[model samples]
Target: MALLVIAACQLMVVLDITIVNIALPHIQSALGFSTTGLAWVVNAYTLTFGGLLLLGGRAGDILGRRRVLVFGVLLFVFASLLGGLAQSSGQLLAARALQGVGGAIASPTALALISTTFGEGPARNRAFGVFAGVSAGGGAIGLLAGGMLVEWLNWRWVLFVNVPIGILIVLATPRWIRESPRHPGHFDLTGALTSTVGMVLLVYGFIRAAQEGWRDPYTLASFAAAVVVLSLFVLVERRSRQPITPLHMFADRNRAGTYGMMLSLSAAIFGMFFFLTLFVQDVLGFSPLAAGFAFLPVSALIAVGAGLASRLLPRFGPKPFLVAGAVLAAGGLGWLTLTDVHSTYAGSILGPMLVFSLGMGMEFVSLTLMALSNVPTRETGAASGLLNATQQVGGSLGLSILVTMFGTAGRSEARQQIPRFLAQATPAERLRFRRTGQLPAPWSDQVLTAGVSAAFVMAAVFTLVAALIAVLVIQVRPSDLARLQGGPDPGPV
Candidate 1:
């Protein structure tokens, strides 16, 4: 029952990442969003969630995990209501950013709760496996749910659906979950503000540079602000007694390597979902529901890989699974680059998606185990928060990089194809193209495919780097294996 509550919270938080993705087209049409601006619908949530995760974790430590969890869920529900009722693009983006704040609070606390609830060994391993599976598969599940809501009702339902689930979790949490002992500490507001603001500026810089080129003044300014703010964050953390982010955690090579692997893998997966969702819907002409179902196999393969890895992890340790998963993920993304305008879903998308999902599933469990296996109980919230932070931050940054590539490639392809399209298109089609600067089918297909293919190529590079990190940096000593098996504490890393 405790695990169920934690998993539910995680699903709601993680699924929000991609659920809105499925509804993006409808939201764009309704809100009159620019092509590039639509990403903020996703980024607004991810950036706040990633940036404030450290603060959220610290809050749990000072308050109590259960108390913070309930507070976070309530905030998330309120934000969902606002998002559902939003009347403009700005309103919706603001609501999404609020939802991220709630998620940042709830997500790390939920993971920390797992440590408090379950004892170490097979029991804890099983709990982590379940949490990891939900985290791994939630994105596809969101797509399916978003499809049903958008097709049967409307896009607003995507945000509205969170209300009921959150209410139930908030009610159930106090009843089933016990609170962690509160430690007296300050909020670290300076550290939180500096880090969160820095990340926002960094992400904005990438997004702006993608749309307006690196020389854009706003992009340069954003990057400069990000550098200065982030440097201040490091300096502040070094001096603070109760820092939100414990810098010493990274001193462990194995843990640091796991964080790096997570960063790279997250970047690849986030880019894959964003681009492929667009490809299936716009290029393939699939209905919203069909596009959602297109990713069903991904959820399944991820489940299979997660289950397999969890069972095998105690035996072979995490390194082999990490290496294998990273390689498979890279291979899958590489295969996706074969997608073309004429390609069919089964021939071009499904096989690679299966391979990629399995690899991702395998990596998630191994990463989770590696991240939390030997951490002290007092710092569980900070440790878990760092892991979640890396995933979200990596996603935001990676998506921006991929979007830049996609836009550049897409524009170049569009320029070449437009003249031919103008000559061949019907008068009505030509008028629409001129009005919207968007080509109609067949012609637009090539442009979309070119951009999608380019994005996948870069995504493949990310996963490959993850694979190399696993091979070169992650080492599980026999003593580490003993700790994983519930042996006595190996003292601080």
Candidate 2:
């Protein structure tokens, strides 16, 4: 029952990430968002969630885990309601940020609860496997659900859907989940302030740079603020008693490598979803529901791979799976680059999508094991939060960076076709086209497809680097799994 509660909370959090993605086109049309700003719907949540995670973890300890969990879920439900009711972009973004605050508290606490609730060995392993599988499939599940909701009900249903789930979780949690006794510790306010503000500035800098040129004064200022603030965050962490994030957590080569792998994996995969949604709807002209179903295979393959990895991990260790998954993901992403305006779902998208899903699923299972395993129990919540932080920051940073690439490449492509398009337009049509500022049939479609393909090529590069890190840096061996089975502490890397 405890494990089920934790998994359900986690599934809800993870589901929000990609479920809104399929509805992005609809959201943009309804909300009047520019392409550059549309990403904020995703990034706003991630930024606050990632930035405050360290503090949220510590809060669970200082307060009680179950107490924090219930509060977080309630907050999430409220935020979801606000999002569903939102009429303006500002309202939606604010609601999303609030949702992140809830998720930040809930997600790490839920993971930590699993560690506290379940005994180590097969019991804990089984618990984590269930948690990991749910999380691994959540993104794909979100895509499908988002599609159906947008097609049948409307885009708002995506946010509205969470309210009921959250309400049920809140009601059931006290019945099933046990609360840990509170610990005595200071809140590390200075550290929290520095880290959260720094990350917000950093993410804003990336978003701004994508819209304005890198030389824009606002961009430079945002970047400068980020650097100065984050440096202060490190300084605060080093000097503070009971720091929100203990810097020593990264001293282990394997643990540090796992963090890096999580970041790279997130960067590659987040960008893939962003651009691919555009490809299917804007390029292939699939309806929202059909586009949702298009990604079903990827979700299934990921679930399969995650289940397989859970079974294999105790035998082969995390290293082989991590390396193999990365290689497979890179190959899949590379194949995605072959897509063009004429390509069909079956011809170009399906096979590569399967390959990507299989690889990511394997990586997800292995990565979770590597990141959370062998940590000191006292630091588990903090460690878990940091891992989740890496995923959020990496996604926001990578997507913002890739948005620049997409926008620039797309505009350049469209410019070449403008002269021909103008030649075919009548005087009145030319005036209308200019007034509306819309791209014509083939050129518009070609530009979007080109940008997405380019982004995928870069995503492949990121996954490949993740593979290199797994090969050369991580040192955890298959024998480590045995140490885990015996119920003694899994030795740190």
lDDT scores in order: 0.88, 0.85
Pairs of residues at least 3 apart in sequence or in different chains that clash in candidate 1: none
State the TM-score for model 1: 0.91
How high is each candidate's TM-score? 0.91, 0.92
lDDT tens readout by residue for model 1, 1-493: 9999999999999889988988988898899985567778888899899988988877887899999999999999999999999999999999999999999999988988987999988999899879977986787789999999999999999999999999999999998999999988888888888988898888888778767888999999999999999999999999998887789999998889989999999899889888888888888888789989998998889889988987766567778889999999999999999999888899999999999999998998888778886688766656767898899989988888888788778888989999999888889988888798878788878987998899999999999999999999988864566686456643221
Off by over 4 Å in 1: 1-7, 113-133, 171-180, 426-428, 477-480, 484-493
User: What alpha-carbon RMSD in Å does predicted model 1 have with respect to the real structure?
Assistant: 3.1
How would you encode candidate 2's per-residue C-alpha lDDT over 126-153 as one tens digit per residue?
9987987788778778988999999999
What's the CA error at residue 235 for candidate 2, in Å?
Answer: 1.1
In lDDT terms, which candidate is top?
A: 1
